[model samples]
Target: MEVATSNPAEETNVWGGGTRPLNASYGKLMMWFFIVSDALTFSGFLVSYGFSRFKNIDSWPIADEVFTHFPFLHGIDAPMYYVALMTFILIFSSVTMVLAVDAGHHMQKGKVTFYMFLTIIGGAVFVGSQAWEWKNFIKGEYGALETKGGQILQFVDQTTGKRVALADIATPIATDRETHLGSNGVWYVSETELPSVSVAEVKAGFEANENVVIRIQKLDENGHKTVLSRAESLEKINAATTVVEGANLIHNEYGNRLFADFFFFITGFHGFHVFSGVIINLIIFFNIIVGTYEKRGHYEMVEKVGLYWHFVDLVWVFVFTFFYLV
Candidate 1:
């Protein structure tokens, strides 16, 4: 048999293989390719979102006004904090995954298991938080009166600059005529209870409420909105309400329903990715616990999954900035 003894340098070169061009292992190489394609997919969604935002630049919903909620602090005016927290949790999970990969490299199974558990916990928490966010958005707050012109006319206090509810601003009606069913007139199909407040009532309230003012969806020089004074706004509202019909894209209290559409698509897609990633990580976690990698004599599986987890974190970083921040 050949001599068993070997020079330490030769041993180092064989096991520690010097860096080569595209020197990554098979698993790592695959991770990079997947990340590239995934990055492009995210970019496509973001670019589409940008296109819509640009088209409705005059009347797009302000992200801050729409997403301002924090857990345990009801009506606190804490915009973007909840989403920011979710982003941090995902980033932290990525950190844990990196640590697990490092531990695996040294064959430290115990460390790998510990870090993997942390990673799973972080992912679960993030997913749950995202669900909570969607719930609040779907169930809108401070509902407004929809005008015939499709423009959302919000009641803002001239003194406070806060949104007042349709009920609070409108006088109590003895008998509301907003019925979905055709009770006496031409009827073939059924109807239901109409919106809480109607255009007619809104016009009447505008005449009565002196403190109330209206802000149209038009853009100013700086791209921000201009809110009209009570007297001026009432005149414009009366003029616009006369000829307006059922809502269209140009008019709606929500500032282009497309805003809601994009919000759902972009955020929903990202959330779905997070969900699938959690499932994948769960599978890997179970394998780790059962000594799958211990038998295989390598921890490449953890490394590969770690790359995906990090890429998700990276995408969220940009999403938060563009969607929530600037």
Candidate 2:
């Protein structure tokens, strides 16, 4: 009996292993795999953030209050303005990446180079803006007092209904204490830089300023920090043990410590991805300038990087929503 012969193409098609799936190259397919895994990782982080915020809804820092900063406009309450600008820049960069990929597809070297350059600039700007934001966050504007019960007590001017800076409210008192060093104290132990004002100084200032009142982390019915009466402020101020000026892994003046932790982690992670994308885009950009893809007769490399750039931009949209808007 003669056996039926199978065509190689038919066998390959049936096995579905040797051919490009969905007409994508091996490199493109691998990039897609990476994007999917990275997306899942981001989702997990965001979900944890959501759960933490929900669990501590009352004490969680309000996004508007925490992100009220604008470049070159210090002391202005421009809530979410700079962050919104950063979001726009990132999304616009994604647009430029698309144009670059399209130009590559059309074999227009000049157009591809121009768009790639714009994309790189946009990514760099976004990374820089994020660093500035982190600086402001860590340095803090209005300092707070931390109680023995881990509660953050912010001072507000009842007259202006606005938060007061530690500098404006703190009374300078002489202190002989200095930061603990490894040499002076325990051989291996050292203390972080001391806060600008001491608790004693803050207490004196609060006592002197009748316009200032203590604002607890808990939100009121109107969704604002709960401000105490003069009598209540005096009572609450006594519980304060330490002065907390800014945010770190150990403490946060913004309300809950978890807010700062998640902010740094998620935003820093996304910033790293943007930074990496910028580097990759630069490499592809130089290759284009050198006519590498031209000799190869395809700009498929640009298209692959474009995919990654789009993914990065999309991820930032979610991050912006969760961290700033929501």
Candidate 3:
């Protein structure tokens, strides 16, 4: 072994010439690797969503109809307005991150801190907006009926050609039904809270409201939900077994249950990413205020975080296009 012994240090050296590959430090390179892996994960989710939507294209919930709510704009039909604002804020935050990184490169601590503060604010606002959107989605506006075969039957005013909420059309009916609890019978069994309106109440209301018609989940050639004739609506309403008020893992008043499933999973996952980025930005922002990066003689940490922020924004672009625009 003494004749030609290999040097352990040389053998273990991954970077042949230097630790910085392509002028990127180890931390920056690692961030790139993490971003690539994360991008692949998001791609997998979006692909699965595309396949599911394609299979149930006709029954898929219309994005405009589902995301019509805006802050303090009750009874207003503003489709995609709030969602577009959220997207704009996120993208603007990415721009601020770029500015912060550029300022850091010039050793301009003041500019870097200012831009970082702006970026953090934008991210926080976006996260809050996402939470608001989730609240509205889980507590759906207009209610619908679910058939035994899992089809959704929405109500619409024939004269106005607009959706009608169950609260407006559903008659109040007294019932002795009660929510099932684990302590009531089986120790491990329980039922979810009962819906606000019962199926029988909705049926009676439908009968009383002659102007309301049933809108099936199936889309017509014009890309709108198929509205049934008055006689057909009566027949279709008879097939409904349950009144669904909001969306959950099991039921969605909008349309196909799978649409809700994908919406929750994909949007929830993306929202988590945005929220994590915000927290990380806050930590970096505090460090900047404390002169941590200034003492280090470089702002490479800011650049590293900037890369992650940009990746989050880019992923949202794809998500927005696929989920809302497409």
- Per-model TM-score versus the true fold: 0.81, 0.94, 0.93
Better of 1 and 3 by TM-score: 3
Candidate 2: lDDT over CA atoms? 0.92
Model 3 CA lDDT for position 220 = 92
Write model 2 residue lDDT over 1-326, tens digit each, in one string: 11223568766575555543376777888999999999999999999999999999888899899988999997889999999999999999999999999999899999999999999999999999999999999988898999999899999999999899888989999998899888997888888688888999999999999999999999988888899999999999999998998899878899998999999999999999999999999999999999999998989999999999999999999999999998
| Per-candidate total of colliding backbone pairs | 9, 0, 0
How does candidate 1 score on lDDT? 0.76
Residue-level lDDT of model 3, residues 208-266, one tens digit each, is 99999999999999898899999999999999999898899999999999888988999
Of the two candidates 2 and 3, the one with more favorable lDDT, higher being better, is 2
lDDT (CA) per prediction: 0.76, 0.92, 0.91
Q: List the residue pairs that clash in candidate 1.
A: 150-251, 150-252, 151-251, 151-252, 152-252, 152-253, 180-191, 180-192, 181-191
Error of 3 at 230 (Å): 1.3
Report the lDDT of model 3 for residue 187: 87
* Candidate 2: residue pairs that collide: none
Worst 10 residues of 3 by lDDT: 1-10
| Strongest candidate by lDDT | 2
